[model samples]
Target: MKAAVKRVPVRNPANALTVLRLVLVPVFAVLTVMSEMTDSSLRIAACVVFGVASLTDFADGWIARTWGLVTAFGKVADPIADKALTGTALVLLSWFAVLPWWVTGLVLARELGVTLIRFWVLRHGVMAASRGGKIKTMLQIAAIAWYLWPFPAGLAGVGPWLMAAAVVVTAVTGLDYVFRALALRRSTRA
Candidate 1:
């Protein structure tokens, strides 16, 4: 007689945090788009929402590591949530005239392109987030936060520069991932 193997369901607090962050994306977008609200109020609200949502990105990883709750779902959900939040913010900001459309488009293109590459690599094996990727994320978050706030009296000229730096880092890290993925494919073929 063959023994039956039990399949364990994947669920974790980390994934829950990721889902929470995903939910916040729309709320942040709505607040950002409503023109009736004062710029100061909108800026404060956007910052609060973005900060809380961004915190989940870190909190989920910490919870996963601390509780031994890492799972494939967490791996997938975390990055998706990150892209949704950041990408949505960038698009909404551009729509509201807080930023130029080209800036947001470049960021989105890098994010989506890298995401596709990640899915392709997943068929082979896990490719964990790199240090460069982490730096890019931090720079992106900082840029978004600065852009959400009112200019001049706040961070002044720092916002646009930070956003441009983030875009550069995003492109560089994305190319690095593409190179790695291609190398993996070549090695596997050989």
Candidate 2:
């Protein structure tokens, strides 16, 4: 006997939100890097855009899971949107000299590498985001948020530390995922 499969449509509210987040990626980067984060108004506007995009990142996933609207597109585009938003901000921040080149490079490398691993293992099976991956995402968001917001001089030093922590989490989770993907790929071959 064959097991029955349920189909989820590609077009849905959840997917729409995911696409919206993707669209916000370039906008957020422009707002962040245009005035070089020096103009207080531009910085604030960038933060608002980043915050809204980040919120949709969570909302779309929640709505999809809760309403059974999950789809292949969501599985792919959602994560892409997330990486685009965070990666763009990190790259732009580094370009503006607000973030260190090493920090941006390390974080983006881990993000892009893990995303590649996901595609690599997709032929074997879909690997859901581990708990550590979720932690890494939240930390990245918080760290990015800290950098975006203009704070008092005394509190400004905390931003880099947060980013450092996020980078650490990103590296750890990225390694974990690579290992899992390799194992899955081997299993499929066996």
Candidate 3:
């Protein structure tokens, strides 16, 4: 007889970090909106809040794997929290004319598409996070942070370059995910 698998508790440090990220999303959005395209205290506060929340994304994943605290809730909520935080940042940056609307739209579309693909292939198998996905996330966070921070005028050019790289990675990884999803579905059928 096969032994039953041990279950990790949903209420753990790792999942707590994920939850914190989700909660911080709205707070970050409010701060960004309050900034109103100025290098005021509100912008700085928004930057700091966004930085903290972004760190939690890394922390929770590390803690989950290191401490074996992986749970179903974490699996579902982690990505949602990540997308929410990034999505809010992107939208706010675009709204304030900090970043272009097309950039925000493209990133949102790719993110949303990937989520849909995951659901499409859910019955066949779970799609693991790829290395490119991690890189895409890092680029997105760095780009968003660059725009959020009230940096000097001279350094203003850096954010767009970072964002451009992020866009490229995002599109590439998204296509890779779709191809992998299709392969998985086909394999399962055969």
The candidate scoring highest on lDDT is: 3
Cα deviation of 134, candidate 3, in Å:
0.3
- How does model 2 fare in lDDT? 0.89
The models' CA-based lDDT, in order, is 0.85, 0.89, 0.94
Winner by lDDT between candidate 2 and candidate 1? 2
Alpha-carbon runs more than 4 Å astray in model 3: none
lDDT of 1 at 140: 93
Candidate 2 on 150-190: residue-level lDDT in tens? 98888888998998889888999989998899899999999
Q: TM-score winner among the candidates?
A: 3
Candidate 2 TM-score to native: 0.92
lDDT of 3 by residue, 16-99 (tens): 999999999999988888779695789989988999999999999999999999998999999999999999999889988889
**Pairs that clash in candidate 1:** none
Q: After superposition on all CA atoms, how large is the RMSD of candidate 1?
A: 2.9
Q: Which ten residues in a row have the lowest lDDT in candidate 2?
A: 28-37
Reference-based TM-score of each model: 0.89, 0.92, 0.96
Clashes of each: 0, 0, 0
Model 2 Cα displacement at 20 (Å)? 1.1
